[model samples]
Target: MSSQLLPRLAQEDESTDALSGPQTVTRQARPLRFITCGSVDDGKSTLIGRLLWDTKAVKEDQAATLRRDSTGQHNELGLPDFARLLDGLQAEREQGITIDVAYRYFATDRRSFIVADTPGHVQYTRNMATGASTADLAVLLVDARAGILEQTRRHATIAALMGIRQFVLAVNKIDLAHYDEAGFQAIAREFREIALSLGVRQITAIPVSALKGENIVLRGDDVMPWYSGPTLVETLEKATQRTGQSTGFRLPVQRVSRPGEGFRGYQGTVAGGSIKPGDSVVVLPSGVEANVKAIVTYDLVRNAAVSGDAITLVLDRPVDISRGDMIAAIDQRPQTGRAFTARLVALSPDGIVPGKRYWLKAGSRRQRVMVRPVSALDLATGNWDDAAVLALNGIGVVELDFEEDAIFDAYETNRETGAFILIDPDTLNTVAGGMIDSRRSRSGRFDALPDADRASITLPARLIEAFLKTEFARAHVGEIRVTRGEKE
Candidate 1:
């Protein structure tokens, strides 16, 4: 959670010495990181197992265990208990539901993949969010019979909020629907409406039967000849990898190394932008400046290091730098302030309380901060409503007041430096995950608002007209007085 692969590394330069033969450099396609999430019994595990099984990512020994565990239980097609390959918990097998997030790594001729199979139950929504936080795309599964349910909407909304641009709609169990093309189209149409409401546009809907392995890695059978679209694996192989919010160079110092004689270096994974020797950098929070003298990795000098590289930087001058301090491009520094507003996902059972002090950790930096709920989202209306507390699995904006200077970029600008976690002092549990929105001044505006005047701010005609186009706005229909700043 401290570091993320935020950007793609540039191709390594091929160098040839005059005394040596030619050298060639080659690299495989970037691996895709995605998550599978939807309602329970939606066949997420089965789908992933089938993917791995068909790809031959599963070893013979593991497949043997699956066969033993599934001894007398085979589907009509004689497929093994594919879901058991992912549901490792005994309780999960007993209840036939996934409770924890399971991750699997696999590869094909085209590309490699890292997929997280997240729980679908409403209670484990936090688990789903955790899996989605770093995902480049989301594969939301649904039963052909059930269509789009509330839980489906919730997962889709969270994935979009977490900045996932690509979505794959796997309409599982098409066999149960008798491979009805009409039913498949109906579900895909409804899901598109929901996705559009959440501002997500890139979506691929495929009718599949995970249990039977149809349209997963192989083409559909004659029954579902109407589904001539690409298989799930084919879609994933061609899907794009995520390149997170771009920003100026940032390196949150994890350690300062003075390993040997006459050598000192700052160690950390580069979070944003690229760095090279001779570039001037600033040690944040202290304003001390230094010039990069070398970029070190595995004792070999690198010509340049970009985001996601784990390298040690040797500077021209010694500065008062330490753990938790950030080193950034001197010309494009991150924001430094004590107060900021952010959107947070409450992850604990106790939820987030107003006026509570929690340890806010962003990258290598951790500080005590007071959190106050400013306003929460009204899921029913998609409106920002005044809220005093943020409940479990709730996603809303809150105000963060740091005891000391807090350095971050707006989440829209740099995901690596802008994301943070809230830890409870008593239990040391991660209570919430947050993304920096925009900094706020040291103002009493939040605490000063009263219930009677909550929605008292008026808007211009153009603004009101803009609000009328939202999905929530249509549900209310002819019911508001914009001049008076109230809603019915």
Candidate 2:
């Protein structure tokens, strides 16, 4: 509840050979962050409502209101309409579908959880992506009657692409299937194939009925005596949080704090690794190095702070540092380049256009960039095929050309430093979410640069740093030599 960032426990997500792997005595437990997703009418909102309801998170007043809302209507079980608990929007209530991401918090005696109930409609894929971006795990639901649909696979692909290794395939509405164990197993098996192919190893597929409140937090063993596996809550209780900060130190400076005279500090959340007083640090994009003078916070000055910790850092010497510059470990600086390969989730109705100039913001830095679609992923086949443009809800790989130097680590290596968003200049709305694949040299992407006339006119002679990174400069290294012209 303290607004400061977390010192999250690093727990390993152990993979097993089988998809329906065994749950063990929890090696670790802590407050977890996760999301629920899948195709439409998969009972995602109902599952979340069931989770909250079973955990006693719903107060008496809320329950009474829900009962009043369901006075005339009757479900198959004559129970409270669980979906209404989260589908608070008028449109959602009228249409009986979720349109936006609704977040809910609940806890068990064993651990706590923060669950984001993302929409299942294809148009709301961007909303789902926003929820999955920060989730450590994904709860992908499926209809026991329908098995795995195209959208189910799509949601799994997006979640895996966002680096969620732990997945729970909730085969919902089992009661509607007449409690058919064979049907549940069949659906669970197919989903495992998809999850494993995505490089996700830890998967727990459970049969559930959200409306009946079976197999969610409490056991449905009375009905499903064959399923000796743990309940959904049990699986979540022992599930591990992703250790996403394996890469070395990285800090994207948010702002320079000067609370009083003679006290200058850099404030930002530590994105990766750890930092301590006297640590050697480098201000990126400028390559100016300094040592840590101190680490300050509202709490007592600490000797060290790890990833996700929000604190102010005082450097040993005065340096040209500001918002949008990275303060990273001197020995482990992130890749700085003018071009990079990235995978993108096209989020807007207009889709992502080729050669369009948009604001590309990664971490604290925002700059003009030209994006070129290379290939889009076929969700059904999981193949990367040639693509000229990314349509809405399309997942594609593209190359990003930056107008200025950009710093990032591969998203597989560091999520915080490697992820970025594209903002349309005209509307100022986010159009896409991109994950860095690898930073490329300017020459690596022949078409990443704009037309020479437009480039030359738009960029001034003062943009010499970028000019030096151009293909011509690298290609004619011996002919084109750089010498510092003295200050005029």
- What pairs collide in candidate 1? none
lDDT of 2 by residue, 115-226 (tens): 9999999999988999999998899999999989989988999998899988888989999898899998888778888888889978888889988888898889989998
RMSD of each: 11.9, 5.9
Model 2 misplacement above 4 A = 1-30, 447-488
Per-residue alpha-carbon lDDT of candidate 1 for residues 1-488, written as tens digits (9 for 90 to 100): 21333333221321101111122222245568999999989999999999999999999999999999998898888879998989999999998899999999998876788999999998888889889988988999999999887788778878987888778899999999989999999998888877777777667788999988898898886778776666888777656567764677899999999988799999999999999999999999999999999999986999899888999999998788899999999999999999999988888889997777899999999999888887886665556799988998787889888879999998767878988999999999999988898898885643433333334446776877898887666765654445643552
Q: In terms of lDDT, which candidate is strongest?
A: 2
Each prediction's total of clashing residue pairs, residues at least 3 apart in sequence or on different chains, is 0, 0
Best by TM-score: 2
* lDDT against true structure, model 2: 0.85
